[model samples]
Target: MELPVRCFVKAVRRCFLSYICLAVFCGCLMGIALIQMIDGSFKMDIFERKQNVTKPRTTTLETPVHISPLRMKELAAKRANKTDLKQKWLNERIERLNKAAQKVQMRREVTARPVEPSDKFHIFYYAWYENVQYDGNWQHWNHEYLKNWRKLDTKVYPTGKHEPPDDIGSNFYPSLGCYSSRDPITIDIHMKQIRDAGVGVLIVSWYPPGLSDGAGRSSDLIFSDLLNAANRHKLKVAPHIEPYNGRNPVNFLTHLKYFVRSYGNHPALYKVKKNGKESTVYYIYDSYRTPASSWKELLSPKGNISIRGSAQDGVFLGLLVDVHHKHEIKRAHFDGFYTYFASNGFSYGSTWKNWKTLSVYAHKNGLLFSPSIGPGYIDTRVRPWNSGNTRHRRRGKYYDVGWRTAISAGADFFSITSFNEWHEGTQIEPAIPKSTNGYTYMDYEPEGPNFYLNLTNWWVNEVLNKTVHF
Candidate 1:
């Protein structure tokens, strides 16, 4: 009986030990699950906080990792600082522009002299040549006349096998030779020559910023120097705005604003007074490129973006290429019209006989008529196929005829075709008699180099002395 009781006690003890081991294993599993839940909740909180503080990063099927709150704060601070700096810089620029405009107004009020209508003789000026500064690239000098000499179909070679600064690609050669517009001495000499010739204004050829003719440098690159030289010589400067790529009404408005803000402050900038109000004058080359409707947007007094009668208002002269262009100019609300071509019969407006009629029409319409005169026209070197347009100098007879016609028509304003357009053989700047390896250049031979200059002085004095009704 005692042995059986001892066996039962041992069995009961074994069963109780197994139950305790099972309890310990279950407790370990529950603890691991609780820890995992707490970790997941903490990660979710962090992601929520990041989303609230910063811009959400793009995410795909893969979950995004949350950036720390400290890092997000740093990024926000950096962006704020950058924005502040940009705003401050813009403000400073605006302030500077305003100050410049004010100074210009004050100076003009104190010292500006009125230019008489009869004394106004404007000249077409070019600033597109290069020299050693361009490293012998022969920029507009070689390329403008003949893009590829090998492909040229002319009977005569343009340059005559001689390079620039000696024998260039022109029917006539300059006394100063192939010169760079960038040279300070050259600029000074040019200013002196024009002033001595009795020219009152220099209508400088200009293109938009970063734009230029084929192989030519931007005209704006030398504009500051030109203005400085003109100021020193007591000559006024006006922009001959050229048509550029992508030009339209919108961009043109921007360009005008930029022009006013940039060079309008210069003392040499040209201005005209009407009814006791002084305004700048701008010559728009190829103004017909933009439709009259587009121009009305900026020129009409009541149109949007209109500068007319505003602080930026000025006399806008459109190119007179055809008789019908006068109607177009009037429809576009242009202030005046000017003939630019040197060749008298090249265009309807350039015809000498039409000057008096046009001048009469202009006066009736309250528009100014400015006739352009040239000594001659010989662009065979540039346009070999178009020789019909060449007009001989006739030893100054042609020029005298043009001047007489303009004066007889009662023109109050006059513009010379060019001061130094060697490529077109219309330069009034002195030209020396030059001959090269196989070519001969035209010049004011019987007279001296200063013959044209003397003639110009005489004509200018005559024009000023006459009574001009405008």
Candidate 2:
């Protein structure tokens, strides 16, 4: 109050400056408090743009409330897992819908259209099945469970017979129900399926006229019907020489003669004219079961009992199980090799990764390379303990992968493992969704009964359009 006018002005200026600074500090604290109240993370972004995808997926974009680091990590993991689950579910739903639409479109063409035979596609056909309607009783439907294959495993190997029609031996149920192979209607239907699928040849399982495999009946009569049906479909027939009770090099010649005299005149008997020579084709199943020395006697030109120069001589293919079979096949003078197992990694021959090496070996050795393709494999119903070889179809992805591998391996020809080998669950024939009291059977869900047939038709076209020469 007693100071000069200039000093009084300076004091007033300092007091105003200090008051303004205090007010600014108070405002900053309130701003911080307001931000915390809104979002704990405080990771504000002015440009919070949406993703530019065709169908933007729902995702969590904000951070959690303040918590322990461990708790935060756990929450993040849960969110990530949830996102992954949503993605998987969406993908499956899309696939199912697409297949449903595709199924509807394909059904219209399936029955009306018939794909012509290229003779490059072969399908393994079976004829041992029997039913009460066609045969006297349910012969093969009530199949016996084989002894435990895995001796070391102590799992219950359920023994006894498969009680059908409520129950059957296979894990899959047929769309046609339990039917006989000899039934005329069944044969016609099978022929139509094969023709519609663009298959050219049927490698029918064969045994000497009256012989068969374990718990199976003679199939020679059924084979005759198959020939007629094949004729109607304009498809060729090749005999799959199964290892019967007394199959040997000496008797094989006789069998060959019998085939020539028996069904040789039929137009459906698959034959080829290579280098001015005409002959039929024979698939030797479990060919390695016999000694390579034994096979040489029949296949080699200079052997004591050779079929090389004979008129009945034909192309011979052997089953390959292991690496040694490679040398065995060559030494035995086989015309070709086929990896028949449906499970991809079940054996050295069946492995997808081994196809290239095998193909190269076959080509270098002047042997035909025909890789076997299967929809899937599951023999748990018959061989209960041997679950290691089971292959799940995963809708249709498994089959597509098989086709891709075959084409990439430069397969000389494509052979489906089975059209109806129900015991091993490798059939591509129609199968309906069926469930019984005790268990539910496997079916091609979402896709119809003819799913594999349609899928096969697509692949056959793919192979034909390709530059691969059969």
- Using all chains and alpha carbons, the TM-scores for the candidates as numbered come to 0.70, 0.76
What are the RMSDs of all candidates, in order? 27.2, 14.1
Model 1: lDDT to the true structure:
0.81
Model 1 error, position 143 (Å): 3.2
* TM accuracy, model 1: 0.70
* lDDT tens per residue, model 1, 1-470: 99999999999999999888888888888899999999999999999898878955655557586779998899899999999999999999999899967953443233212333223899999998776554455755663444434455536534333356665767887787777888888899988878877888999998878988756778988898999999998899999998988788789888888888889889999999965788898999999888888898889897788987776789999999988888898888888899988898999989999999999988989888888999889987776656778999887778888888888887868989989887888888888888877778889887767767667766776666663323
Model 2, span 1-470: residue lDDT tens = 55688898999999999999999999999999998977854433322332233434444455333568898799999999999999999999999999967964664245323457678999999888888877888877888899985668887778999988879999999999999887899899999888889999999999877788866677776777889889988999999989998889999899889888889889999987755787888899999999999999889999899988777788898999998998999999999999989999999999988998999999999998889999999998989887888999887778878988989988988889889999899999999888888799999877878889988887887677773333
Question: All candidates' lDDT scores?
Answer: 0.81, 0.86
Q: Which is the leading candidate under lDDT?
A: 2
**Poorly placed runs, candidate 2 (over 4 Å):** 1-114, 467-470
lDDT of 2: 0.86
Count of clashes, each model: 0, 0
